[model samples]
Target: MDDPVLRFNLRELPVPMVYATHRIIRDCNEEFSELFGYSRSDLVDRSFARLYPKHADFVRTGHMWGAHLPGGKTYYDERIMTASDGHRFWCRVHGRTRHPTDPFAQAIYCFQALTRPVVLGKIRLTDRQRQIATLVAQGKTSAQIAEEIAISVRTVESHRARLMKAARLTNAAELVAWFSTQNSS
Candidate 1:
C-alpha cells in the first residue's frame, strides 16, 4: 500500500479519497471531487483547510491529529465538513501518513459520509450548549469548563442537565460520548 503505484490508483477507488502532502491536496479521486463538489483542478495543490466548515475546525483538527500521525498512527474522527457550495455534512474521516517520521510530507485520507438523521435527530443546540458540548467532547471537566467559560458551577450543571434531557441521555459520561461521537462522524 505504501507503493507509489498503489497510491496513484486511489483515484479509482469507489470511496472518496485524497492524497495530500504537507496539508496541501496533491490528488483526489473522482468520488472525492464529486462528493465535495470540487473539480480536480479546484482541489489539486490547494490547502486541505478549504474542506473544513470553519477555520476553528481546521485548527482544532490539526491540533487533534498532529502528535499521533508522526508516530505512525492512523487517526480517525467524525466531523462536519463543507461542500464546495458551503453546505455542511458529517463525515467519518480515516487518515494515515506515509512518512511516519514526517507525517505531513505525505498522507492519505478517506471519507465516509454518515447518516444525519440517526445522529442529530435534527436537534439544534444553542450556542452556549454547543460550546459546552465541544468542551465536554474535548474531555474537559465541568469545573474546567465553568472556569473557562466564566459561568458558575451551578449554572453549568443546570445547562448540562437541560442538554441531557434534550438529547435524552442519562449522565455526563453519556453526554460526553454522544457529543464526541456526533462531532466525530
Candidate 2:
C-alpha cells in the first residue's frame, strides 16, 4: 500500500509564521500579524528588523544564525521582541531555511509568545540584558560574549553589571545560578 499524502497550510497552522527572502518578509500568516501587531500589508516586502526591539539584536541574531543556518541547522532561541505597539514581550522563535546551501536566501520562521514574566536574578531585564544574561549563564565571559554579539567587552560587562544589580546578585556565579533555576522552572 502507498503511504497517504499529507497536506499542511502555513496560514492554517494557528501559529505566527513568516516566509522571508534575504531577511525581507515576503509573506506571513494572519497569526503573525496578530502576534506582532502588524498587518499583512505592512510586513510584506519589509525587513524583519521591525520586529526586533533593538538594532543590536537584529545584527547579533543575524550574525549568530547566519553562521548556522547555512549549514542546514535549525535555530531556536527565547528572546524579547517588540510588537507594533512597542510593548516588549518574550518569545520563543524557531527558524530554518529552505535552501541549506544559501540559507538566508529563503527561510521560514515561527514565533511563540512567552507571556510568563521573565525575571533575571529577580530583576526584569530588557531584551539586550536578557541576551547578555543568557550568555553569562552559559559560562561565557564578557569578552567572549562581546565577540559573539559583535559588541565590546566593556559594553558586555556594563550589561552584566546591570543584570547583577537588578537581580540583586553579588557576582556572576549567583546570576548564573538564578538564570539556570529560572530556565529549569
Candidate 3:
C-alpha cells in the first residue's frame, strides 16, 4: 500500500502542511511540525484554535462560516499568533481543497511565517518634541503653551527650534500644517 504520509508530502503543497480534515480531527504533515515548533502528534488531535490567542473568536467564526463560501480559499492574512515561548508573529495562511474520496479531507493550508520584527530607524521623534508638536497643532503660541504646560517661554521656543530643524519645516505655518495633518488620524 502507498504510504499515505508520503503521498501527501509528494503533493509538495506550498502550505506548511495539509490539514486532512477539521482542526480537531485531522493530521498535519512534517513541514507543519517544523514550522510551528509542534510535533505532528502534538497537533494531530488539537484544534487550530489552540494556536490562536485566547480572545480570538473571529478566527473560529471565520473558519466555520467562511470556509464554505465560493472563492474563499484563502485562510487568513496577517493573523497574530503567540508562540510557546511567549513571542508573537504575524502570519498568512492559504488553504486548498482536496479530493472528495480523501478521508473527508477538504483543504491544504500553507503557512507563511511573518513574525519578523522590522525596525525603521529613520526620523525618530522624542517625547518632548511630540508634545510640543501637539501644542503647535492645536494652534497654541509658544508663550501660551509654555504658560499652559508650566514651562518657560524660552524653553518652549527652544523646543520649537529643535522641532523645526528635525522636521525640516521653514516656518510656523508649515509647522502648524504639518503637525495638523500628523494629528488628523
Candidate 4:
C-alpha cells in the first residue's frame, strides 16, 4: 500500500454516508443507506453515476484516467460531488486498479474517500499578497513592481520578504514565479 494508513470505506465509521461500487455490483454502508434514503436492496446493479448527473464524463479527466493504469494509484485532493438533493460536498478520493480474480477478465476499480478537510490551518496569504504574487508571476521584479505600484523599493522588498515567509519559499525570484501560479485562481 502506498499510504500506510490507507483505508477502504473508512468513511462509514464517521461520515454520514458511504457508497462502494464496481461495474454492476454496488454496496452501501448503513450510513449511506440512511443518508441517501435508499434501502440496501434498492441499490444493487445501479450505475453509481445515477446519483449524480452526467457522471460518464468524470472518467474522462486526467486524474481519474491516471488512476486506471496498471498497478497505478492516485489521490484526488478534493472533488466536488453532487448529492441526490443537488448539494455538493468535497471528497478526498483515492483509487487503485485491481486485477480481476478471474484470470480472463480485466482489472477492476477500487476507491475510497476521506471524511476530513484537506487543509486545517487558517491561510496566511492576504488578498494583497496574492495580487503581488500574481504580479510576480507576470515576471515583474521588485524594483519594477515598486515602480508600477508607486511604492518604495524597500517596501516592495519587504513585501517580497513577507510573501516568501508566508508562502514558504527559499528565494525571492523563485517565490515571485511560484507565488504567481500558487495564488492564481
Q: What digit string (tens of lDDT, one per residue) describes model 4 on residues 1-185?
A: 58678576633464443333343325555555444455656655565565432353243332233433335333232243445665443344443444433211222332334343323223455544644554575567878767655678898778778878766779867774454233121
Which tens-of-lDDT digit does each residue in 5-109 have in candidate 3? Answer: 645352355556656454452766666766667777777767676666453333533443243423433433334455555455545666655543332255556
- Candidate 4 TM-score to native: 0.38
Residue-wise C-alpha lDDT for candidate 1, range 1-185, written one tens digit per residue: 58565454877799999998988999999999998998999999999899986676787677656756886679776667889997778778889998959877888999998764224434576656766776676577889778766788788788888989988999878987677545322
Candidate 2 stretches with Cα past 4 Å from truth are 118-129, 136-167, 170-185
Q: lDDT of each structure?
A: 0.78, 0.79, 0.58, 0.48
What lDDT tens digits, residue by residue, belong to model 2 across residues 1-185? Answer: 99999887777878899899999999899999999888889999999899887887887788877876885678776666788998777788899988868888989999999755543333556767767887786678999788777789999999888777767889888987776545211
Give the local distance difference test score of model 4.
Answer: 0.48
Question: Candidate 1 — worst ten consecutive residues by lDDT sum?
Answer: 114-123
Model 3 error, position 144 (Å)? 46
TM-score of each: 0.67, 0.73, 0.46, 0.38
Give the range of the ten consecutive residues with the poorest summed lDDT in model 4: 102-111
- Where does candidate 4 stray beyond 4 Å? 1-22, 34-37, 61-63, 66-69, 72-74, 100-185
Identify the superior model by lDDT, candidate 2 or candidate 3: 2
User: lDDT of model 3 at residue 19?
Assistant: 64
Give the 10-residue window scoring lowest on summed lDDT in candidate 2. 115-124
